[model samples]
Target: MFFTPFFKMLLHKKYILYLRVFTSLVINRTFIPMTRRFLWLLTCCIVLLSACDKRMVTADNPPETNNPTTGAPPISDKKVQAGVQGIVTDANNDPLAGARVVCGDQNTITDQYGAFRFQEVNMTEAAAVVTVQKAGYFNGIRTFRVTAPGRDQFVQVQLLPKTTAGTFDATAGGVVAASNAQFIFVPNQVLDAANKPYKGQATLSYAFINPESNDFADIMPGDLRAVNDKNELVALQSFGMMALELQGATGEKLHPDGTNSVTFRMVIPATLRKTAPAVIPLWHFNESTGLWEQEGSAEKMGDSYVGTVKHFSFWNCDAQFPMVNFKAVFKDDKNNPLAYTAIQLTRNNNSSSYGYTDEAGEVSGLVPANEQVTISVKDQCGKIIFSKNAGPWSTDANAGTFNVSIDPDARLALSGKVTTCDGAAVTKGLVNIQVNGVHYETAIQNGNYATSILRCATGAATVVLNPIDETADKMSTSTFQLAPGNYTRDLQACDVIQVSTISLLLEGQTTTFTSPADSVLFTSYRSDTSTVSIYSLSAAQKTPGGLIRINIQLSGIQTGPSVSRYFTVAMNDGTYFSESLNITITRTGIAGEYLEGTFSGNVQKIPGNTTAPVSGSFKVRIE
Candidate 1:
């Protein structure tokens, strides 16, 4: 323990040197392997000495430290921290669950209640760019600020429904243009997915550019001119593609019905003939697929090409092809050429090209080509006179000649009078005529009506008379067949009738009866030509547990036999009532005073047409 001063000083100096060497080696990466053992020994000695020295560092001067493996930059802590919470909803305030809410780098999905919250979000700026999105809804964005920590900032967002904004209607018969390019927009039907009319306002536009024009340049919407009550715009330039945009057209609008339409007109410049000699093809830009799809071919209008569309979007016509002329001759059964006939060339998808035959029985026009094509000729009445499959058409070999003969006696004219079984015309009703499942509606006038249909050689044809009034009578239906010719028949439209079979053949005949069970008077009206008595019966009967009342009204003159509406109670002592049913009545003569008609559609407590058969006739004395 006791040592010389020189030896002790020497030992102290060596320890200091070892400590300095070990500390320097630990801090730097340049130490060699040869000094590794010696450095380890120095480190152990320094640790023991440090405990004895009791050394410490203040917070103001901390030791330097760094990561050992990655050599990456140190992460920085944000100075301000905040949170955001909100709900996403539709225009009606209905919650939109599973909506994606994004703010800065933090994103959270909405819960079932459409609520979303971001915890411990680091604020980057004064306002956070918050976005909310959901399927079938417009994307919503809001610039929101978070003032306080947790649960302080809240937002409620409402998204509108996307729908069609406008319609493009192409004119039916466009004016032929002599220019090379033409633009036309015809408003077809605008309807929702359910085929309802589109109620909201929409903006429609088109871009007309030469085929060589730049597609990147933007075209502003042109001024719209009102033609009558319709939205129409005459083309300001000869050509370019147009983009359509809609504003304030969200909510409940997707499809539109036929009543919604507009016509767009574009004038073809004189230079169009040299630039685009072929017909103009209509093009629609597909947003989903990012491609141009052909909608239909346009009809040539004077200095323009016109076409109709049911929606508003980017539309144009730049793609073109050469036109080819196809000639067809139409004739009758005896080889006699027909004039002014409509000839149609149809493709597989039902795209049609039409032309009219001239006095020489020849129809020649430029027609487009498709894979599977067919040619057909029709008379002026829209009845097909001849049909042939002309499929696998080539645009290269577009010109051809064909001769067709059709039977002239292939159509029929059907004329009839709708009356009740008692020979009274149904004046205040509609006659629904159906042939082969096709329906045509005609209003009943003067108890007489007429409708045309394709003559069917087999199966029965049906005629139904539906009254458009308030009465308890039933709808009347009749069934028959016809040959190719003009014919007239009297139809009886009424509910099922149950009555005593008595054919009275003379005039001035009267029949009266009183219900034994209900004490209701049934008085019949008669005509001088028939024995049928049109009766007026009304009664308040109490059966089936409730009191029921019936009423019928008629004041007129008649030429044919007439029958009265019977208030027949299907249940014992009970009557059916409806506010929308009516019976039939027909009158012929001076001032239509004599009355006759049949009755159907009765609201027996069930509130619909009854099958019960009832008939009657009545005559009012001429004063």
Candidate 2:
């Protein structure tokens, strides 16, 4: 141990330079005399210095870590893949085909059944936002939690039609009322599309959504989930909601300036009036994010909740509640997944939320925490297929799989083949079925259609089938009374007509309209005369000061198909009218059922002497 202190010094990383100098002196025989013990000690010191260097290097650069079981990177660091599927419908619960749906970076269009799916979407957040857009309706949005990876969630969005409530001049703002909702606009507060002050006549379109309505679950924008002022996701109990929009005289979009606020008064439903909070948070729908964000607060005055907003879109008076993630899977008695089925969750306070099952029969969303809720699965006909009480979960949890036993006597399966008038298979079509006042629709594939319906009624069930042939543009109607069981039948698109469609071509543009979005009337007079009136008002013309209006009036003596009659076209509140022209009238084989025809002529603007050539076709149901 002659060089014990020197060995210790060499082991210290900070003394490496001194160790190098000592080793160099020893090698040159200047620091110490040569000896076997000294050489051995030098060897030991070198070994210890190497070991200390290795320890410092290891501390700076550690080995890569792996999962103990998988021997790969941890799963928590990887991106998760989840899927979403759903349906889009109108306020009447009718499917909206060709609607555009978007979620995150994925986008798709709805099929004939209003169904859409996005598979294997990359998700990194706890929730996902979905938005739906279709012409002639307001935008539909939903935000739900993505509870698990590799799982598909379903959402149903119902779009409300855009309707004008009232109008006022932008220079002298006034009040407008729609149903139980009232709006107050301040003078010189309206801004046009360019964000400049607008001085023209303004049209106000509004809709007051009553949360107690049967269609509230479908018609509401979101699942009552919102982000509070603290940026925390929470559930909401809505008192009422109002959707508003303002447009200038020439159809330019308008909104209130940031410096000025618009006053809103929403009447709470009688059922919820007693429980309505005196002051509640006001949230506005964010179209880009498809989520509601807290903006301000509203106060209750009598039966109405009044609030002021800086701009316009959708405003709601809602009370917030703590929430936790909920998930479950549903299966039939045979262990088959109950895919694309409706599921509803009703809170103890009567407030409700809804979701649909995906292809795997799985549904997930945020629910109120520590509260009792009743979950019900319903068939297309609105019959409850299964019901159960689910608990007050204090944390995120899955309720596991639920097996539903459907009564065989309550199930109705219908399968059939559809053909065109010439006995050719109708490749593209729709099978619309109506039972017990509820409508169900399915797409036709290669002339074959099949669907299962669940009915709770006993005895014979009355069913109405309306098959449409897209290939030949034809349709047929049939009714049957049968017991609840599987049945096979064939349908032909022949004489029975049940459609109201019209198309007008003026100049180089074609404007096509379809009912029940448009109004087409067929009135028969007692004097052996009949008249067909077709009226279509665009979204702009639904308000005052709108300049464009399309109307067609047909009148003639009693005549059948292929007979040409006199008709006139009017525009802009009869400011312009077409000179008398020839139009053919045809009965659709069934008396008092429908009228079909075509027309071509010139429309002249009164006092201006401007005439435009117009041609169009129509197929209208008799009223």
Candidate 3:
């Protein structure tokens, strides 16, 4: 079996060399900013320096700890307790939030700066795993061990952008072009927390409309009908990642190069959106006035406005949204109106419903007030897309007409900005706000952008900003609260230079013997027996996150008898907690170079559960 001393000796040498190589390549880790047009094109082409993976982890059985009082409170006679706080940044120095910080079952999210705190962590409870999650970025989870009582720890979470290995296989997924827009999906190679293949069923369908007919956005993608082993026809709005990629000309992705395949990896939030159906939000697109009008909410030609139940009602919107509008232009073979449509209402059971097509070729009516009701629309062939109780239609199927009155607490107004370090306004940045976890994303506009999307008590919601530069792993965040009215504040970027490394000298500066620098993550890991010191060069540190090339110097070595080996020192918090190194190492590289990796995790737990959640993470990457 491989031994620690031998591996350590080898890693010492590898780390030194990586620093020398990357430092000479770029002046700094930051990327040169680009305009939106070019930025979009760059994304469509290729992303640079990606080495990310999405790995999830869940812990039910807590690990055993050797400490006499690993999870015990400090109030006891002998154990002393102390507080901990710090910032967790990626290798690129970006603060990571929602990074799982656990002391047994307790956990917390990092603030804007990746900052966290464990009010009074006991040094005895020193085992932890920090999991990081941000949209468009790679997901990471790492384990660590605690060594002492009452101590503060620093951490780094090095993240790599979401990327695939090499070009995709034909069936993988790609971008598709429609009338005047493009769209793409996330990759579908998802694995569960246990690294097991997620075996769930899925359903998708949509109709093909001729663009010349002025149909809904020309061609649209369909929504999920059902998933899991069950073929139950789930509502399209219920699909999480399964939600239809809506608005072809205005989809979110940059639209990849060729038109072969595309991937999407998100889950729908049917639970949270339980009340967001069109049941109370019927809208009419008016061609004449260039507006969307609400049907029964307003008089035919009296007011050209559409009332939004959950938001500001057209009746109260002043000039923002109208209370009535128009529809019906496309003509079917029967001289009847034919157009794409959807519903966002609920159907009670034990009820039958029916209605006639208006001038707009659409129909509506209350389903019989039964335990379950089926409200459906007719397709071009006069065939049912699927009875409300039948199945979902391909391409699209909006929920039914809205008829309920919205409570006063639903609508809220919000505004914010995207700026640089110096406070200069930035136009190309994207900010996504999560209120009570409801998402409202917007950009700063051609010149600027902001919206009044309502949010709930999260007290203040989290604001995440993305740079227009495709290569930067930087993301900015802030927290704020809002009531029923207007609120404004400035948002800042918190993403840091987690691995802002640069070599100092010329070529041939590589060496042997991993140094502290090579071990960018100054962390302690725990195991049942002892604490293990992990390195980007060791197995303990290898994660799907970014890799920072660590360089080591050859201290000295003895010759003969010793065989070359490549192993790793990992933080095994599964069974127990121990601070310090239970040292494990490996010898990698054909000639004499090593490049493993590091991941994300918290520092507070490693010390003890007595403390709150510590704010710290680690980044592992290679040059």
Candidate 4:
């Protein structure tokens, strides 16, 4: 009825022709009256238009596009391929690795970066509901649409804590008197077999006598918490074989009535550990017997070990690590104990302790007892002059007396000095060396680094030194091929300007930027005829100070010709609008030589709008 006027307007203009056609199909053209004929045509036109209005379109069944190449008909539905990428983090934005993420049938665990990806997802399937689960955090469930084929859907999932499991406060918990150590556990809320909150109680027990001088300094904060595969929280109280007991009221299990067990994890320091993921039994302290009894073993996860307990008690790790005193004497092939030799002892637990021989060639110290003991002797240059595996620990009371011999010709020594570009000592720098495949990390003492005496290699040995820590961004790699003898090399380390001041003056306004200039990373690529040096520097972003970044690429070294150079600059707003217009390279050098230059450019804020002038200078050593 609403469109009656519209139909009347169309009928008024074209009713005569339509009437003639209808009358012609009947007896004669002039037989029917014009009014009756017009009415009949209107009724038929309204029914035809109403039928067309019934055809509907929706998102699930979209209109199709024709394929032009083969002149094929349009296909309304087609299968699509897609992918999903997401990051799993805690409430604090810290990445959570080992979190399991599931999308339909496909699932993956987050990597160290808290990133996971599901590739080749079939878009034709129902909308995916991604479920993220990790112990100590609430479950994260989100429904996301899969984009078209060859496309990716990126998401960031933050797992919130179900409730606070309270802190492992060493000070308040009375583990140690007035200790500054604290560890907090934000555990995910879980349901027990009775469909109740899995909230249990905890108690810590320890040996009264402290083994170390400072118990608080022995354990780190991050070592106290661990998550199991089922996403359950585990707390640890560790010192030199200290006990941590977790239990529920009465005789209730730590987990649920139906569940097999509750789990806990311990992070062992790499310096004191031999191998990761090794199985160590969990021992319960017997209050009456005054001894520890084995309950079960813990499995390793990377650097930490996860142990499940059927019942809670005063649980401690039974690694059976024995502490013993070693009296070792080193000597050359002849029957004489060598003096002034550095004896290094490594136990199966990977715990290391060392001592130097006295004038009488006797070196006594405490070492871990194991099935096999590794002893190495080295002289000043920091190489292993003598290395061998001694037999197991003796049953006698005095531990053991080791008599070892070293070959005189096997000694090889390497030494170097690490210094800044201005010849200042970088005393806090660290250098990591890789020989064959074994890695040795040494620190710079008084700007000098040295290795102890090393045994001769069977074949050609390759040694590489990588500068790290304070001098990581600065410093060239040093590689050497050696046979034997004492060698000394001086290394000119790269310099990092912790604080750099950059300013932009334009439009009667001065904007200053200060940041820790950690952006300088120098690298080179070489071919038979061409070698190029690339320097990239940028200010740290998203800090209290603003952001500034610059990238420089230079070619043709030592020739002194005007080398082809390109650079880009980014300012506070993260808009890389500053395109290089003119750059001046005043000085250039390689290998401990400094590269000094100035750059000026106009930043195009908008099309045909005002542009800001930017300029800066830098002086950094070439790698």
Give the best candidate by TM-score: 2
**Ranking of all candidate structures by their lDDT, best first:** 2, 4, 1, 3
Over 4 Å off, model 3: 1-408, 421-424, 432-441, 451-477, 492-623
Clash pairs detected, candidate 2: none
Q: Candidate 3 on 1-623: residue-level lDDT in tens?
A: 45565335435543334323322322122231233333333232222101012222113321222111122221112323433333344534445543444432223345444554443333323223333445434333322222234333222333333432222211222333222122332233222333232233211211211112211111111111111112111212211111111111122222111112222111112232333332222322212111223322211111111121211111111111101111112223223222122221233422122222321323322221122335444332223333335222222233433222212243344555655665656656565544432233455553344454322222443443333311243345455545554556666544542442212111213222223333232211222222322212221111323221222211112221221122111123432121221111222221112323221112122334332211111222321
Q: Assess the local accuracy of residue 22 in candidate 2 as a C-alpha lDDT between 0 and 100.
A: 39
The whole-model lDDT of each prediction reads 0.40, 0.66, 0.28, 0.45
lDDT of 1 by residue, 391-455 (tens): 45454343344555444254344556767656677766655543322234455667766544334
lDDT score at residue 434, model 1, on the 0-100 scale:
39
Q: Is candidate 1 or candidate 2 better by TM-score?
A: 2
Worst 10 residues of 3 by lDDT: 314-323
- State TM-scores per candidate: 0.22, 0.55, 0.23, 0.28
Q: Rank the candidates by TM-score, best first.
A: 2, 4, 3, 1
Task: Give residue 321's error in model 4 in angstroms.
Answer: 26
RMSD of 3: 30.9
